[model samples]
Target: MISTRIWNALPGPALVRLLILLIVVAAVVLVLFEYVFPWISEYLALQETTVEET
Candidate 1:
């Protein structure tokens, strides 16, 4: 049974290109979130806080 009509409307080559583009974009986002982004945030937070004086 067919569920979607839009896939049938698209040419087969276009569908494959769309899937590949989605995968590459998802990978780029994950790399930034896991490695580069957290370090920048931590450095900024540390700069904002004040040390206690004895």
Candidate 2:
């Protein structure tokens, strides 16, 4: 697949490549949690409703 080809094209030893991949994955996760999650939460927030009786 394209990803496998790209992975094979990366430079350095297997360990170095693995470390780089891990760092990239971590960065993506951190960005999503820190930025994307909060932005999505703002739009998805639940509102409380009040009912009145006469």
Candidate 3:
């Protein structure tokens, strides 16, 4: 059964569908790497610890 009618609105062949899905995944990953990760890192600062000099 079709869970939602909105999804069916994107009519396309199998290859086209696969390409669109790939593009969407790539876009999300790009956003994470380019903006989201860097912004989050500023707050986390997961490397704050430092060794003392003798």
Candidate 4:
């Protein structure tokens, strides 16, 4: 329902649609890098496992 509503609301032009899609993708990537990645790094133990044995 929400997706359909969004689809229906979008402009009916190929170029405009592409622009909107690109803007949305850019915003999502920005949010992920700025907020989500930093928040997730605090919980992951990725630094605890390494190949160094000295």
lDDT score for residue 9 of model 3: 52
How far residue 24's Cα lies from its native spot in candidate 3, in Å, is 0.6
- Candidates arranged by TM-score, highest first: 2, 4, 3, 1
Query: Residue 8's C-alpha lDDT in candidate 4?
Result: 68
Model 3, range 1-54, lDDT digits (tens) per residue? 472453465569767866776787899999999999999999996879888999
Deviation from native of the Cα of residue 8 in model 2, angstroms: 1.6
The TM-score leader among the candidates is 2
Q: Write the per-residue lDDT of candidate 1 for residues 1-54, one digit (tens) a residue.
A: 352554455456876857866777899999899988987888677657788999
TM-score of 2: 0.73
Residue pairs with backbone overlap in model 1: none
Scored by CA lDDT, what does every candidate get? 0.73, 0.86, 0.79, 0.85
- The reply for model 2, stretches above 4 Å from the true place, is 46-54
CA deviation > 4 Å runs, candidate 3: 1-9, 50-54
Q: After superposition, how far is residue 16 of candidate 1 from its true place, in Å?
A: 1.0
What is the lDDT for 50 in model 1?
Answer: 85
List, residue by residue over 1-54, the lDDT tens digit for candidate 2.
997986798789999888888898999999999999888878874555567998
Q: Pick out the ten consecutive residues of candidate 4 with the lowest summed lDDT.
A: 3-12
